[model samples]
Target: MHPLGTVLRSRYKIIHPLGSGGFGETYLAEDLDIPTTPKPKCVVKHLKPQNQNEVLLKIAKGLFNREAEILYRLDKIHNQVPELFAHFEENGEFYLVQEFIDGHDLSKEIIAGQPWGEAEVKKLLRDVLEVLVVIHQQSIIHRDIKPHNIMRRRQDGKIVLIDFGAVKEIKCLETNTQGQVTSSILIGTNGYMPNEQANGKPKLSSDVYAVGMLGIQALTGIPPQNLPEDPVTGEIIWRDQTNVSDRFAEVLTNMVRSHFSQRYQTAAEALQALTQSPPTPKSDRWRSLSNRKVIATGGAVLLGSIMSLYVVSRYFAKSPTPPNPQAVTPQPPIVTPKPPSTIKKFSQLPCDSDQQLSSPPPATGKPTWETDVYKYYGQINQKTKEANGRGLMAFKQNNFQYYGDFKKNKRSGCGRLSYPAKSNIDYYLGQFENDEPQGLGYLKLRNGNEYRGKFAKNKCQGEGVYIYADKTERDGIWREDKLEGSDNFSCKGSSASSMPTISFLSPKPF
Candidate 1:
């Protein structure tokens, strides 16, 4: 337990211990530097590495620093995310200071065995999804998304996402000479975590799955683990237990699909679907048009036009003297009304070729899969090769799908690599060589952050412009993944001219 009234760095004085976890302890503290009438309360997290081994300690320190940098980046732009005050190492232990939110976590409000109303559920989903959109856009995923991690702001009743301690970096696991797999640390709540996440391979969609579980728990008043799942499909069977509209059920179903490919690709997409109006049936639209009073009015006009035509013919035949050409008045041409064009139904709309509505085969088929390699080769007057052509490739093991030109079974020429349901750098579209990003290309991380410019060996190198999640741009030369110069990057909309720079610390030591 952290000692009460303990001051660190002669600035923040610990008021009380909030909680403690396996890796860290949290405390409510007051910032003494601000001599205002009411001292600002902040959260101080003490991160102590569990292992004394140097290698494990180094990894833990690197992860801790990386998380702090991520929080700093997000807090600068987003209001829902907690703001970082300061982070430092004291007595070989790391401590992070952040803005304390004065609100209760959702766990207190969301009680087990008590179902939430439809309107309340909808509001909850929207609020959380909006926050997630920002978190994901910043290329960060709140790995541990649960009722306890969400706080409802007392001032505005807005949902705030907290606790990014479990945030995981995008890295592939390794194997020893014996071909045995060495797993990465799995970091997610058990019931809320999807299969992929439980296996230590969480994607952006994994967060969506967790959110869906929350929704289900709210609606059914049952925990996710206790909810019954279909034996064959593995989908949670909660419709019978709850009374939600079919449309919302569909959205939730897609969100918590067993396969990541079938889930909403992003929080933005999920929010759009959740808020979208229900589609009106094509038959109902046609029925309404047919029942309209316009048809009766059209019939009366047609009868009137016929009678006038007869009267004009009779008068002309009975006339003693021929009417002068100039004296004959020209009647306005009778125009027939055209029925409305067939209402195009939603089902008739063009299908998204990339979207998989159902469970796709575990393996997407052959490696040399190209939809039209011959056409591409013919356009260039080159013969197509089995191992080389322009097409799409799916690497199931790494959860990556590549679409572009391939040479000798490698990603060559131009191509795009995407993680179908994950965030961070979601995809890279640019020049490729030997199955890696090379030369110039554009990279979009899952959190809406972007980088355009030169690349080498699958990393940002040379001259490039990096756009942060807050729409701030940094134009500089990059080596590996860090900016070259010591000059601080300027952030837009911020009073400070220079942003804090974090050194590039490698998670895996070479």
Candidate 2:
């Protein structure tokens, strides 16, 4: 353990040890470099090797750097994710400096025997799922998600996900017949982790299960491990323990299904279903009636005139003529059409924007045709004569073309910016605002590298993940096309400066 007042790198001065675990220990420290009135406090995680082994140390070093990189990237992606300030290795011991979240963990709020209301549980689920949506979008499955790992910030009360130590891929000094290192390091809490995660084959849906289990604990006032399960199906049997709406209960049941395949594949899908879930009934009688199920035709069934003979006998208690089971004609089940989506569809655009022209000339030679930065075609404002609504714009100078929705002469909706004349395929297809890829979008470069995430002002901003041609990914927050963080390590080869970098400059095709 680091002694009090010990300063590492002549910068971070340790204040006190926060906690310790099997892998490492965390300490609260102060950054002396920043010249603030009160030295900003940060959390320092110390990862030490079990023993001095050359091969094991090399492997652990690589794993530690990779984990730090992941955390550094995720920090920029969302506010709820703690920011990673720096990571370093001092005297064979690795350390990570992170943002000190000033808040208490969910364990304080979700106490045993102190159950939360349905509304409170629902709010927690929504908050966690929203953060999971961002994390999962980068193809990351948070193996460990529990009350202790999640904190409620004291300032704003937002749920902050902490402690990604489990995400690190570390292995012991054990080799198989092929001389490849092998170690089974199962990462996750017992109660929160599902079966698949426990077996070390975790999926995005596995994280969803953990979040659902947390919600159930909050509602039932019982720890997830303490909750009873079905003897046959192995599903959690907690409905009788909590007073929640059938709609919500069904959602939670599906989320915690024993089979990963039965659960929602992604957090976004789960969030959508949860948001659309109906509210609780005003009366228990109404809920009971709504929850009623239809029995088989041969048994007691409840419907208008299709009541079975058994149902008629029990309800009426009188001899009534029942329809012949063999003669009864079965009617097709009625399916209610889903409500129209609130988001406007790009296909609803009035003009055909997919048509690509070889040059900047219109086929019909319309007189409204004009040019500024590029040749414009399709619809135009009758009064202002500016490129408005759905249209196509081609720039011969940049050898680029744009096709899709436009508003008031700006690309303000769904659109595709591509370079047809180029030897390689390069394009950006997604939401646009003022001729820039704004909000969620996909950018694929000619070199096979791709970026999938949020953008703003023609730059990769907010949470995004850049996928290299070799399949390795870098996930984090971006501002004006740059990742925001600093890394200075003293290890032999674990310095962030030694790591390779990639540029995501906007092509300015628009």
Question: What are the RMSDs of all candidates, in order?
Answer: 28.3, 22.1
For candidate 1, write residues 310-353 as lDDT tens digits: 76688778997776644444343468996432221110111111
Candidate 2 lDDT trough over 10 residues, lowest sum: 344-353
Task: Please list the residue runs of candidate 1 whose C-alpha ends up more than 4 Å from where it truly belongs after superposition.
Answer: 167-185, 291-510
Model 2, clash count?
Answer: 3
The reply for model 2, stretches above 4 Å from the true place, is 167-178, 278-510
lDDT of 2 by residue, 340-367 (tens): 4322121111111122211234423543
Model 2 earns a TM-score of: 0.54
TM-score of 1: 0.56
Against the hidden true structure, what lDDT does model 1 obtain? 0.67
Candidate 2's displacement at residue 269, Å, is 1.4
